[model samples]
Target: MDQFILTFLKNASEKNFQQLTGRFLPHYFTLISKVGGMISPETLTSIQKALQEGRLADIVSKIQEVITAAENAVLEVAVIGESGTGKSSFINALRGLSHTAEEAADVGVVETTMHKTPYQHPKYPKVTFWDLPGTGTPNFLPDTYLDKVGFEYYDFFIIISSSRFTLNDARLAQKIKDSGKKFYFVRTKVDSDLYNEEKTKPTTFKEDRVLQQIRDYCLANLSDIGVSEPRIFLISNFDLDRFDFPKLEETLLKEVPCHKRHMFALLLPNISDASIEIKRSFLQEKIWLEALRSAALAFIPCMTFLMGFDLPQQEQCLKGYRSYFGLDDKSIEEIAEKLDTPVQDIKGHLKCLDFWSLVKDDSIVAKSINCVEAFCAVNGGPSSSVVQGFKAYILRSKFLNVVADDAKHLLREIETVNIA
Candidate 1:
């Protein structure tokens, strides 16, 4: 299955393949690195031939196999730091679970992760977050810590702190780097610092000044310990919108392997409009593939009878999309409570989809479907049978855009009002 994916992607430029997959083709490594090595010559020729001939069913099963392999790729993230640095909280936040949630990392006065512990995201089970035991203890030595924790297991590491950066953090980071792995430095609990400053200094305290002071303090602390340049993030675990959490998320998304990027993007908690768009684009990839699968049913009478119209599938996709984007009613209600804003204000941002009216000739969904038909008509992509492939594609695209727009609008409102 993995080799077949590499073969198809290598041949994606073939006319018939381009017509069916559209322009949203993702960027990925030329070879499946984990699966390893170039596909055999015979497999490549067969895939290219099937695509060139536009024999949809011939390649469709292979298409299904390759998509499954890509979607199920395993990813591991390690969160490492000293005790009381909010590493557990960061892990919980990254996984989008409350501290009190059953599967959440243990958050308390006593350290619970005495050894490395793994937490699988409820939605994206393949992407696991490891809460590593605290470093810099009497028993903790930088040289041996990596081995003790089985460092080779993680794709990347995030080293965290809540106060002035320490020599231990620097030493551990250097070790991780020397081992040929990526590591990020994170300073947590910025909200607590800001609140204390504002309360104690009352009249003269400026939020910007305090934030800069904290930032400079971390930089200077790390620089003094021989870290020439540190990729550091200031984040408040309790308040993701308060600091550099979004930046951290963005950096991680870009740094992870390309095949894992789509899953990583979808799993990101919606804290900024940029992150929301990342999720939107990743979700669109899924929609396109679903459209192809749905279109395939149009040709297969048995499957068509079993799974009627693309309508139900579209509805189901949007339902999951809304939950992921925090645009759903429950998610909006939670945000509304946090912001002290009326639920209606946030909910109003969502563009309603009138499914009944969509079947009518004059409706927006109908109009969009017609546009796709016109596209197929003019292009004459192979033949009319191939044209039928794009019908579901356009329908899913419209619904997805509505969800993306709504999410961005809601995020803008939240940011404008200041979630701080």
Candidate 2:
């Protein structure tokens, strides 16, 4: 038994060893003893009690439930501003949808929103952006605006303005602060401002100088309106990679709670290399958790017979990674259309197995198991069931790394196309 455990730990790490020793080792020993026809009556009664209890599956299921809840967590954001402030356009941009897209908020020069309209993000449906009605109107008063719009529903507020922040904006900010909710000030249509400045001033205009002036002007106005230490982000609905969009994204991620920060970072448009890398890191952090989940699933009776020890779970995980990185067929087509490049040209840059094919084909799972088995045979096959769990964990980690690499490659391909 000691030799078996030593061989198992040789293949498995100390972490997995500790987990198995604490949770499954007793049952494993009983199972082995029964198989070897050496079970005493006392041990048999204990095994029967363990079998009757059956808490392992329940515990694993509860863990899975918690993980699913975290992944599907909702992030409610309120986009509020006065009339003609490009609030809807900014919401559309945040969702990675064009103004004319069917899922986009109504983007009109006039105030189109009469009530609070919730727009679910195209990629992350749980992340809802509410396009609140224009403030400072006869019906929507600043003092009672929070009550009218049900401000309690929002996780955070974004106060937008095309020019300087208004008194209404400041009041809303103060109200949000009083309610213990965070708010951000966004100066929209910055691309237009920069373009006009460059066109009119030519050699005399410095881009950085113009941007700084705009920032200072917004800050001063916001400060005058009673918003202390005002943080203003300048952005353009038409161009997310420019101006202060990246900084705004970073700031929001830092401000939001830990569980919801991934939702914000993952849903951000794949516009810049920094954004892509942020998404990559976010996904990378989940690999270990996913590997453990898959390993646990492999210990389930029906799942134990599956090729590659829970390859379906691994395939599903990789599929999700592909979707999050915008590498699925639909997303790829969208990128290709946006870049004016053929879909095949983008697909050629992928470094891993085709994501859809891997999920759809069982033969792929068998082939993967065969490869793993061959490799393990050369390295000395895992000596026990616990060692097999560790083997599955390692295999899943390798597959995650491969999928991540493919995502990075696809992002670089998109970037190259954009530059060209």
Candidate 3:
């Protein structure tokens, strides 16, 4: 297979190679040019070997494999704080679940989490949020907290506090830093504080001023305890869209490794317009890679035996987009239930063609195949089997855009309901 790929590249003109490589290997090119310093030695070696051997197909396959592995990778986020700081509620919010949801972390005014408990995201199970036991409790003292909770296992930590950042929080942050792990200070229950302030001083109270005061207080506390330049995010567990939660989400996406950033963006709760837009852009960037993978798979000799290959792959990719954007029937039903609105009302907002129906439509399939044949004819007519892959790529790319637009429209509808 490698020999065949090498021979094919050798026969192709340099201009053709450049055009094809630009189309199919855009992600690889971006990674090499933008993140060259951060690429792992093993990954660099694999890419260099593919280039040296002129195995275009293998390179595409390897790139797709790397992306798939990253998508399936486990992301462990630890939520640690003093007891009654709303860590459990924050975890639930982050996972897009109500505190009453079956898999939600237990929330209480008292210390509920006695031990480190991992709660998997309802939609993306590969992403787990660990609710670590309270830091200042006698059972889990600040001094030995990191070792007790197995700190190394977590990709990052969120050290939360209800009021002021305490000495225990500062110590934990320092410890996490010393261990070379990232930690963010989260000031939770800001809604309760704001409510109290509004009630006490309704005439003079300003939400922005109150929020700034809270932030400054938290910063002062952390600074007094010798924690330098602490990154503090203020949030309300009940309202993730308010205050600093969006900025926190952006920071996490930027700070994590490149592959993991994609997972974070994809799995983020579809609460705010900004979040929905981010998800759309991340998935959009991924379409080229998916198309290239489809094209490469089409070139495989044995792929013809696998039920013609292209249709099934296209179906799977479309299904993934549906699942990711919460466009499927189950997701829509859940949203309707949560908003106390009719399921049809929510579904009405969707502007995309029904992907599931299209997958089963014989006419659409025939039209797609014909379109592929026409495309091949314009390029001097490639083999029918090979053309099927190109058809799959084009079809998937078209639907991907449709699903993304539908997701945006759905988000607007939800926002309208929220406003009302």
- The per-model lDDT (C-alpha) reads 0.68, 0.68, 0.72
What are the per-residue Cα lDDT tens digits for candidate 1 across 24-111?
1222223222222122335345544665565556655654654565587788999988898998999899888788878788998877
- Which whole-number lDDT from 0 to 100 does residue 111 have in model 2? 66
- Model 3 weakest lDDT span, ten residues long: 1-10
lDDT rank order: 3, 1, 2
lDDT of 2: 0.68
Estimate TM-scores for all models. 0.73, 0.75, 0.82
Model 3, 232-264: lDDT tens digits are 999998888888999899888877876676777
Q: What clash pairs does model 2 have?
A: none
Model 1 alpha-carbon miss at residue 355, Å: 5.6
Cα deviation of 137, candidate 2, in Å: 2.7
Candidate 1 displacement at residue 389 in angstroms:
3.3
Instruction: Using TM-score as the measure, name the better of candidate 2 and candidate 3.
Output: 3
